[model samples]
Target chain A: MPVVGMVGGGQLARMTAAAAVGLGATFRVLAESANESAALVTHDVAIGSHLSLPDIAAFAAECDVITFDHEHVPGAILAELESAGVLVRPGSAALGYTQNKLAMRERLSSLGVPCPRFAPVVSVADVEKFAAGSWPVVLKAVRGGYDGKGVWVCDSAVEAAEVISHGIPLLAEEFVPFRRELAALVAMSPSGQGAAYPVVQTIQVDGICREVIAPAPGLDPDLAIEAEAMALGIAAQLGVTGLLAVELFETRAGGLLANELAMRPHNSGHWTIEGAVTSQFEQHLRAVLDLPLGSCVPAGTFTVMANLLGGTDPDVFDRYIHVMAADPTVKVHFYGKEVRQGRKIGHVTIVGGPGDSVESLRDRARRAASYLRWGTEDGE
Target chain B: MPVVGMVGGGQLARMTAAAAVGLGATFRVLAESANESAALVTHDVAIGSHLSLPDIAAFAAECDVITFDHEHVPGAILAELESAGVLVRPGSAALGYTQNKLAMRERLSSLGVPCPRFAPVVSVADVEKFAAGSWPVVLKAVRGGYDGKGVWVCDSAVEAAEVISHGIPLLAEEFVPFRRELAALVAMSPSGQGAAYPVVQTIQVDGICREVIAPAPGLDPDLAIEAEAMALGIAAQLGVTGLLAVELFETRAGGLLANELAMRPHNSGHWTIEGAVTSQFEQHLRAVLDLPLGSCVPAGTFTVMANLLGGTDPDVFDRYIHVMAADPTVKVHFYGKEVRQGRKIGHVTIVGGPGDSVESLRDRARRAASYLRWGTEDGE
Candidate 1:
């Protein structure tokens, strides 16, 4: 059996390990701690940091291919692994675009892909120059930011200057006033076959994804197709051999612009676990291993996913019985993590049939998530 | 978190471990060997024999609730665990019925449940007397029979006399010329809440389950309800706390008769993995932990599951890429076992939408399984 080594031992890796079991493949996770989600489930786990070259090399030595649960690995380490002949899906070259915001913007721009105007910032002057054409710009750290961290929206150059003082390499982009954010997820194999999941409307709060609705609810079919095509195009152009999530902004002016790129299973595709014929985690495994991708057809007419953010109560098991009894059809997934307010602990997914509406499914999922998070049935 | 200790570490235990992860619960397995299916995946594994009382007692001490993957454990051992105040789902009293065929027949018959006429047999004379009423009788060991093992079909006293010389405890059952074998699966929590999966038609080969069709094609709606009611009745009467599989015979007379009983997850319910909202594995976890049972609603119009029996090819991973590419909608489940002739290595499940016929779904699933088993696309 071919061994797949995942760089991060988070929930994504944990789910992927479960998927790999079905394929009878060896799945190894490199974890910083023994208690990490994936490390707890998988038998072949190497306790190591993703940043340590020796640790990564040792883990890679046992693996036929190296993939990732998160895109936090340093590009240099991935490049080094590539040079040493270790197969890394979404190779260092493609991962470079996801590792640094400026690199992604430059590459996408060069490909004539729909993207917001962006500029690398050495100082506030760089932001000011970009702001001359579009005000209220978004400032982001070039690397190492997740779940709303290292991102700032500034209305003035003064705010941009204050952010620049943080000393992190920065990039400024024209902040599109979007009606809603959408994510297009696609999986590609080294053989060049691609599978696209339905475009989903991602609900973000404080720049963190809170919920997602497959097929984008009432979005035009043509737009969904266009978004899927764009994501497929990005995966093909980047030579990405795994799941590619293109987060797009649905501009108020009736156009879509790519906001970010994630080269692994993304949170926006979580609903696919129960709602689609094939899950993103399984597809990722198949793609990285250069196997054929599974069908991306939705199993239900409407599917909704709501993140189970940690709340006041820490004991989630106590609430599980109540949540399960309340909504018999809802699927609840919990990441083995201690509860802390606002942390992504787990999620709930619900699928509605053809006769059911998206709003009803969303409400059911949110209610289930609320019950799991805070033990409330009313979803407060 | 409640730690569930499963006595046998087979595929049932392996899948339950995966389900326990979703519930944020800890799962432990006691396997006779380190290479057992569940032992390979679960983090907490105790290498011990199920027959060892000391080993089971030590394993039970670490578990909040103890369950079983197989019913091979002795009744005295389970009774001992109960006496020790260790929580055991489907307590020893109920498990006794599944462990001994004569006991099951007596109990169900006393309950006025529909069951095939059966009697204990000490010699060929007893079998001859039973055969006097029913010509063709099915002879089975009172204990320790599985997958066609320890079973015989006696057409006359001469045949029964030859089998009696083996000196194993025996029982003779009236052989029903049935239309097909069907299974009704139910999960019940300690609180008495119960959920039932759709009745399924099980195709058996040499007494081993080969394929299962959910919703039992051509089954009368009233008969399906009756079978579910009977299964639920058995669960309640027997005090089965986790999964209860009631194997039935649809007789030529158009009524159902209970054929066998399983206290744990059974091969017949494997279709629920992709066909039902809550899989049997997950439902078992929820029920054993005294949590609310999840819904057993079907996910699609129909579903077919076919077992992947090991064949000439031992390299399953080598064929996975081809199998997945050939049928994108088929969900394959591998048991992580070395292939051997006639051994159940894995299974494949495929769901059909409203527009698809059950015949088509079964064909697709069978083709996928054949390809997986023989490494031939044409299923030759």
Candidate 2:
């Protein structure tokens, strides 16, 4: 069995571990803690921080192909590894653009990919001018942001100034009114056999994805096709291996713009586990290991995945009973995480349609997830 | 948080670890080896063997409930624990009848539950008398039977006599020319609440289950209702805690006969992991711990579960690509067991239809499991 080394140890790495088992592949995990990564499920666990060069060198030496749980590894080290003959999927040069939001915008723009008008903001003055053109401007941290963190929306100069801190370069962008948030997930094989799942609508709450609806309800077939094509084109152009999640904005103005790029598995593709024939996790293993890519097609007309956020209450087991008994169709997946406020504790994926409609499925998924967090019988 | 002590260590325990995490239940695994049971996932490995009563007592001392990863534990030891004031779910008395086929038959006869007529034959002469009443007899070893082992079908008096002498005292039954095989999966709580998944048709080949079609496709509605009722009655009467799989033979004579019983998580119920709202693992945890039982309604009218037999091929990974790419709708699960011929390695579940008709589901399910094994494009 080929050994696949992963950079970060999170749920994505955990899922990859599940996929690797099916393929009879080995996973070499580099987690900060013993229980942080899916390492417990697999063969080898390397306990260390991602920043340590010797730790990474030891991890790299034991694996056949190297991949990422998240794209946070320093580019210099990756480049050094590459020069020293280590195989890195989505090699360092392409990964650099994704690691830094500023570099991402510049590269995508140069490649003629559609994106929102944006400007770098090191100070309040930069935000003041951007917000003046549009009623609301989006302020984003240049690096390290997830789940609505380090992001702000400014209706005017005052709001944007609140987030502008000393010495940190931020970016301000036109806050385009969007019809829905969509994601086009593609697995680009080492040989470049690109496979794309149907465009899915991702519901965001406080900037963190709360739910994902596959086939993006009410989406035009042509628009979805275009989005998928764009995702494939971007992955192939970048010569990327493994999964690439192209997060998009389906603007009310009638065009899909690239919102962001994720080099590893993303929350929006969770529905694929139940709704697609081949899960993104399985396809990622196939791609990074340079094996034949599995099919990426929707199995159901509609699939809904709701994120389980650890809410205010500490003991949610009481609520899980209510959620499970409420519906027989929704599938719940809870991570082995100690519950904390607003943390992604788990998720529920529901697939229906052609037989069961989108509304019923969505309601069931929403009710199941909400019940887990808040024990609401009447809410949905 | 109550602690549940488990015997043995394997994938079933690994999945149970995932469920116990959500419920905040602690599992103290008494495994034969390190990192063998689901307790390994939670790092709750108790390094000891079920054979060692001293070590077993120490494990039992920590847990509030005693359960099992398998049904191989000595019945005498179990009775001793119950005598010593340990709370063992489905105590030795209940499990003894299940562990021994002869005892099970005698108990079922006394209880007047409908079952196949059988005689406990200790020698070839006793088998001759049994064969005279039933020309085709199914012979089974009294203990430790799994995945088509310890079973034989004798069509001739010569074969019957030879078969009986070969094994220890065994149960020989009149073979039922059944229309279809079915399973009544019921979760029996400590409080005696019984939850039943729709009776599902069991697809078999050479005495091994290949697929399970929910609602036992094409059976009369009354028959489906009766199966659930019979399962509930047995669960309640036996005071069986946790889940009980009542495998039944739907005969050509138009009645269901009890075939076998499993007190813990059984292979027949694996479909619930993806096809039902709550998995059997979750339900088992809830029931054994005396929590409220969840609804047992089918997720769809048709949820088919197919078992994957370990094959002799070295290129096993290719089979994954063929099945996953061919049918994204089919749910596949592998146990991460080292492969060998004719082994119950894993299973695939495919759910279909308009949420009605058991036969339709059975057909779909049969095709999913068979396709994986045979690598065919045509579904059952």
True contacts kept of each: 0.71, 0.12
Model 1 pairs in collision: none
By summed lDDT, which 10 consecutive residues of candidate 1 chain A come out lowest?
A17-26
By TM-score, how accurate is candidate 2? 0.87
Which stretch of 10 consecutive residues in model 2 chain B shows the poorest summed lDDT?
B35-44
How do all models score by TM-score? 0.98, 0.87
Model 1, residue B108: C-alpha shift (Å): 0.4
For candidate 1, lDDT tens digit of each residue in A44-78? 78999999989999999999999999998898999
Scored against the true structure, residue A4 in model 2 reaches a CA lDDT of 84
Evaluated on chain B only, candidate 1 has a TM-score of 0.98
